[model samples]
Target: MRIRIVLTFILLATGLLGCTEQRATVAVPQTAQASFSWFEYQGSDPVFAEPLAPDQYQNPVVAGFFPDPSITRRGDDYYMAVSSFTYTPGVPILHSRDLVNWQLIGHALTRESQLDVSGARGSRGIFAPTLRYHDGVFYMITTLIDNGGNFFVTATDPAGPWSDPVWLPELDGIDPDIFFDDDGRVYIAHNGPPPGEPLYEGHRAIWLWEFDPKLQKVKASSGRIIVNGGVDLSKQPIWIEAPHLYKINDWYYLLCAEGGTADEHSEVVFRTRSLDQAFEPYEGNPILTQRDLDPSRPDPITTAGHADIVQTPDGEWWAIFLATRAYDQRFYNTGREAFLLPVSWQDDWPTILPAGETVTYRPVRPAGLDNHPVLEPLTGNFTWRDEFNQPALNFHWSLLRDFARQWLKIANDKLQVQPQAGRLSSLEPVSFIGRRQQHMHYRASTALTLSASGLSAGITALQSEAYHYYLGVRRSSNGTTIFLEQADGEGVDIIASEQLSVSGDTEIGLAIEGDKDKVRFFYQLDGETWLPLGGSFDGKLLSTQVAGGFVGTMLGLHSRLEKQDI
Candidate 1:
């Protein structure tokens, strides 16, 4: 059966236009910002249509800085894993059924012993991983940045109490994936530094070895070279990484991502009749590439590779892969997210997104399926506005580091944050905040009345340990004033600041509009017209390149000592 899919693109008005539509032109609301509440408030609700579920199929199904997706299917269930970079609780596991809707399951690695992520640089923590199920066990194999190696873990359930990582002593390089052959022998394939190349050359070539699940070691005699990036023209001499093996009928298929994972990144596939034989390239090797998509639309899916194939209970085949969506010219709020594409077998080879060049919209739902689950709403009436009367921290608030018992207190309808001496750049601050990067355009505002004399308090949009964009009200020697600061590679800079009247209590508002890359600071005198204190500060500080960390931007409040030596 032939299916024709039509995708319609809608551009929502940002702050540049007014708040309503008259006939043909739509006015962008002045208050529109980059928060979940702002998106819902502006009536820019997500639609629940099929190809892409309006509400659930947000641009990045997996938000934040997650990248290099590897998914596996068990019966009607789906599990996905991604490169966690420098985040503490690495290897996040997501569960889904329809591929479009996903829920965050428990993290696979929780302890520092399993993966020492402390001081790991941006884009350099846990690399690409493969999630697979063999027998009654779920297995994951990945690499650790700054640590010399690849490792594997197992759990009885995908939403797991995963085991401690078993380091593969002989295995080297990154982007490790596992394949359990039909004969019950498990094979591990990864992109390792090519042979005879300089030891400093971190570039990878595909290598395979027999992995023992019992001993959790790479058998020395079982190692062999599979493919090299320097030899193949289409594969390119760049870095060939994120390799996964699949077996269909009598053929073993090898899939790897090439071209450096930037704008030129692509998914390449090849197959071999025997597991040990040299692989033959696919006639139409690059099953997927975004180079053909309209360059004007911000090409939501960049670096689209690191894919894994799975078959549903109904025998429908699909591939889950990682793709990044750009929020602006250079920033991606959702990071690398999980995307699904339908797959077809043509002449004993696999084809992905066969209907067209790019996945403009959701593909046709597989036939004979009627029990698809309903997608959940990604937005709601939630923001930084809080009464502080609750006994516990709201679900929206998460500490920069792990949550400790002694860092916060709630009583007398007030939230008191204990002053800590450490700088915010060390991820040691006791501050906590909410994170939801669903919309490219929205706003977040909060009111805080200070009670301490020597403490500095303010709201901030944090990207990582060292990078942040903040518009905060603090008590200087001149009295309470509003200041906007941004952190680039060099460090934080006060881009704009203004002195405000001192009082027993004051109201400070901060709004960040993601699309326009602007932030506006406002203060209300006696609850009147919101006087704008600052306007349109650049948000380039939130980019991964400038920010130099693995986490996406999160909105939250913080307090620090007036002096570093405190």
Candidate 2:
């Protein structure tokens, strides 16, 4: 909600005007301002529209770069949140009545004061978040990697204006999950370094601390290490993170994501009769994993772990975790997605999926959920369009960081973007708003009236500061120049460009298409036919394999201003 403040300032200061075909004749600063008549973006992928039986639900209930999912329920209403990293309004909060049908309600962190991702890299700010509800308050506890340490925010209503961070300086670590005990006590569990130093490469520990819900702080001297180096340090389990503590059947169970976040990621379980006692690793330690499955399997869902289990009103147990849908070999542009599965108990140990079992595409619906299909599917192939008609931008749309300064606004169904000096190569926030590239074979396009000034306003498929593609139209006395620039290790290189003697009012249609490992850029002056701007470029660089981040590709509307104004 605070984004509106930054946008409003930008709109007024930059001579905000109602966007129309005629408004393009009115010129602002040639170097640093541009507004859109209306921006339209849609995805065309064929994988999401399959026929679903009345009794089954899709595996990835929520798709895209939404990873490290944490969920809580109140009666029949369920609320979930996912990690957003440096993108702000960080921590997208979603609501689901039937657990299968979900809607993005709002964001947990919105204001600049609430979340300052100023100097953080593309995937370096926010880490895994664990959302919980206790005593009529929703708590989102997580770590800030490059910014601050562990902190949490609270809100009476999950969809709302959450309080600012209450920093947990003493409770250091990432992926912090808060547990409210049945006996009126509170605890926080997180993945941290092992006691007394480094044991192995991926050696990590799960630590617990006594938390005071009243004071809203961690109690000093109540810290303890619950699981050292995963289920067993001798085996040297790597990246034992994302710990969620739950009490069921009178036993405190500690569940965590084992191994690094790759093909080897898995969830393991440990339990103890009391919090003060040593935890006993489950006989079948890694209760859930796809690592042992054949890599060449068809339509595979790999890198599954970081799971959190919840119970329905009917006492049915279900789990939500993060996984990836990859093509070729571990090449996923859609990022880590949220997957759903059922929890089955074997000899009192909760298991999401058996060791050798492959995660299914369509799983049976939770025991008693009514058939409520989502209006827009997040899984598989789906198309999403935004005309900027809403009072605010959709929660799914993201800025590079907090919308803290003058950059953009939404007015009269148009997304008015004021071009900024920062380019996609700068670590700081740029004049950009993006949506997840949610499919292996997909296309996203937008229409914008070019300023013909010192700005190039068009579309971008961005992976990071240095790894992205920009296709924009710049208008000047020299006429309209449509160009495509690719950013990578060496630097920005113009892949292709074209010159045209065009007017400023022409609503230029720009689009980006990605097919697995490659991408293409296009632009249109007539708004119907797409003229190629650049040949196919390597889309693999957008994947985590080359970009090396915790996020996926984002197709965004970008307008970069000239460095030296003429």
List TM-scores for all candidates, in order: 0.79, 0.92
Q: What TM-score does structure 1 among the candidates reach?
A: 0.79
lDDT of candidate 2 over 247-363, digit per residue (tens): 999999999999989888999899999998999999886878888888788768889999999999889899999998877857788899888998998779898888788888788
* C-alpha positional error of residue 160 in candidate 2 after TM-score superposition, expressed in Å: 0.7
Cα displacement (angstroms), candidate 1, residue 546, comes to 5.6
Q: What tens-digit string does per-residue lDDT give for candidate 1 at 3-92?
A: 111111121111111112222212222221111111111112132122444333333455445567788877767788877665546677
Candidate number of the best lDDT: 2
Model 1 clash pairs?
A: 17-28, 18-27, 18-28, 33-441, 33-442, 33-443, 34-442, 34-443, 47-54, 51-362
Q: lDDT of each model, Cα atoms only?
A: 0.61, 0.80
Among all windows of ten consecutive residues in candidate 1, which has the lowest summed lDDT? 34-43
Candidate with the greatest TM-score versus the true structure? 2
RMSD from true fold, candidate 2? 7.1
Which portions of model 1 show Cα errors greater than 4 Å?
1-60, 198-203, 230-235, 292-294, 297-300, 327-331, 354-356, 368-419, 424-436, 446-451, 464-466, 476-478, 500-509, 521-531, 544-551, 564-566
**CA deviation > 4 Å runs, candidate 2:** 1-32, 44-46, 563-566
